[model samples]
Target: MFHIGYIRVPRSTWSVGRRFYSSEIQKKTIGFIGLGQMGYPMAQNLHKATKSTHRFIIYDNNAGATTKFTSSNSDTKAVSTPRDVAAESDIVFTMLPASAHVRAVYEGSDGVLEGVTPGVVCVDCSTIDVRTARDVAKNVEAKQAVMLDAPVSGGTPAAQNGTLTFMVGAPQSQFEGVKEFLQKMGKNVFYCGENGTGQAAKICNNMMLGICMVGASETFNLGLRLGLEPELLNKILNTSSGRSWSTDTYHLVPGLNPNVPASKDYEGGFGVSLMAKDLGLAVSAATEVKSSVMLGSAAEQMYKIIAGTEGYEKKDFSVVFRWLGGEKIGKGKGK
Candidate 1:
């Protein structure tokens, strides 16, 4: 029950309260670019979460993707370029593929900077190099815009389920301002210092992930070769100190882990090509800082081998197990 100017009002039956709340809300405009595998679902969730008065403007290099997305989401307007999307929005989100792609969209002639207002907040969710991320942020700042490097984790499934984890790097003043949007698309959001640290965190995490996955795959192959059952070896690894996400959650061996990319013939998960790219970024960063990432460098080379194999590049990074087992590697070469 609530009192309004000496009148008692039952809160549960107060229709005016709902009207008062709705009238006080301000509508926001959101822009999204790069409608790829992960980006598509992420944009979908953001739209679903704030469809009331928040507007969503979108753009993608692929015309078909923009058309399909707008067709389904009537409230979303598809635009010509990234700049146009930014022009019509107050907050812009980009989920591009690589550093080069991110640079193009944010720094090109008709880029986000050209269209965004001075105070527009731009968030990049691409897994790119720290150098590129910082460069982009600097450019955004030059235009008096705030930029946040917010790379995400979890595979396509987590993306679709709106449970991805975001590692964000932004100014202290701007982190809280953009966190509400991040929360719409992610289950966890970690603010990791300034400018390019988000890319740093993501690359470092992926580097260790590649190392662990490769090590686990090799260990599993060795255990099987030494006459231990695959399931038994996996159980031992999961229980012992050798346990990691590679061993327990996303195990490489088929029939050992269900509903994983390994079980689906290495489809719809983090690809070998992407893992190799992240490893290369790690190696490059290590070299820049004179840091000796011995195991990380070796893991980069291993992923490179897997990426070079035809039909293996698009498969899950865990397919290193298949390569180790000598199944589908080394084609058209004299052995």
Candidate 2:
């Protein structure tokens, strides 16, 4: 199921040649598509940030998600299709799951392109392949509308907290025009360059993250087998050169960080399958550029294994810890 959020404004707000009051801000119709785990919270934050005058529209392939959102946010208008979203929105944001989904939402029959008006700004937050991102942008431009590949980082927690980092690939002018809107759902908004660079940055980051998580899992597992306590090892590593985001902020040891996925049996966060997909993207990109990524390739394979394993595919990527033979340190049970 696909979902969209649309924001509408009164016609008088765009009336021709009228002198506007200094305090009168023109309301914009904003559309958000894809109301999955990350998208749901992102749309919630954006909807909260927008003024009451702006009409919000939303649609989702999952009818339950749309119903849940509308039940909470009564002002939002739920639409039937991506095209319907485009027809009523000045700005559209899509946060699909994969490259193929992004393509279908934009290029399929009765898709966003079919209903998009010239000059409308389209922003894609899906972490897709660079080629797909660029191709979609080109098609959106051919329709006389502006499109930006603005994939994000920070996972589900960041999305819910409105602190995700946006890596945007678009012209400076176009990026500047939408910076404020992006800020409503993120803490950092970086203009990464032309189309596809955002996806490039995202894939690179996730690839590194995947590698780091694997390394962290290996280290912790080895340490446990050597009679070193998980918390003790984590403390030493975090305070020493071994410290990295994987070790400090998102440690794979379950009881080390109560807020991270590891503490919850890796139920919610970036899924193992998603991480495997991103690693696959990185491997493909590396191959295309002839860049050697031995560790990345190895990490990709590890994630692929995890994704294929029963009961692990849908869990958080951090479950690599358990998969690597790390001990399960339940909350309040670890020293």
Candidate 3:
């Protein structure tokens, strides 16, 4: 039985319900897939913020995630595949890795498009590309569903604190319809433009992030060699206009900020694999447009080194600067 802000729908017609609860709050009952580091907390925050009238349905390739998510909410249940998530909800959110995975999840016979439960909206928060995001949206509209490329900024902590910023590529009216639901999961929201612009914004932002992290690491290491304490140097740089979100919140100055990934042995945050993937998307986009991405190119290559040599497990990207100093920094996955 699906409950939406006290409104009950017949089980058989739930497939087409326009998020009864959320539609009133301008919200929606969301189905989620890919419960990794970001997704797990994201889904949890969404569930807890809403009234009990809202419900959740989930699916993941990993059984452990299914178990953990189910354990968190007794009423929440797991499904077998991506299609199941799409079939059961008013809207679906996907936080997958790349375009390939996104395609397979929706284009495959057993994927989301199979039975999207008409009037349903599918939002892909995964940081994919402009072209892929647009194409995926076309497929969604053809099935009489809506799609938005609402990729986010601010990683795991934001996901947990519900402070993430969403750059949404969606129509104005459509975006308005889903914003209430999205607001429950995040604090900042912007409707960037049509279909793929949100993803475009994401790639450009990450291209900057890649360069900033690398710059912070290089400068910090160089300053340390020049007799400055890593922590003190980081503090000065951050306060003196050289700071970025990485330098402030992420604070690559390991052991200084006990809360960031750097202090936790580079575990429990955005995975290196995801960074590599985002940089790769940046590189590909740069190539397609023949844009002068001097810094992005170098960062993409650096990510390759980190991914291949250090393993794409879960290291904070700040570790790349340490890798530059030749100490063979941390790995995302255990070696």
The model with the greatest lDDT is 2
lDDT of 3 by residue, 1-335 (tens): 54433356664664433454423443345688888777788888877876365668888889999998899788787999888888777778888878998999999878999958557788888899899999999999997788999998888889888998899998666887678767987999999999999999999999899888888888876676666666677779778989788888897766778998878767777766678789889889989989889888888888877877744345767777667761232222111
Residue 335, candidate 3: Cα error in Å is 29
* Residue 223, candidate 3: C-alpha displacement in angstroms: 0.4
24-68 per-residue lDDT for model 2 (tens digits): 445557899999999999999999988464678987889999999
Candidate 1's displacement at residue 164, Å, is 1.5
Candidate 3 vs. true structure, TM-score: 0.89
Error of 3 at 89 (Å): 1.1
Worst 10 residues of 2 by lDDT: 14-23
Local accuracy of candidate 1 as per-residue lDDT tens digits, 270-330: 8888899999999999999999999999999988988999888789898998888623322
| All-Cα superposition RMSD per candidate | 8.0, 4.9, 5.0
Candidate 3 or 2, higher lDDT: 2
Candidate 3 lDDT for residue 6:
37
Cand. 2 Cα-lDDT: 0.86
* lDDT, candidate 3, at 227: 62
Which candidate tops TM-score?
Answer: 2
How well does candidate 1 score on lDDT at residue 238? 82
Order by TM-score, highest first: 2, 3, 1
Where in model 1 is the C-alpha error above 4 Å? 1-25, 326-335
TM values, all candidates: 0.88, 0.91, 0.89
Q: Compute the lDDT of residue 19 as modeled in candidate 2.
A: 12
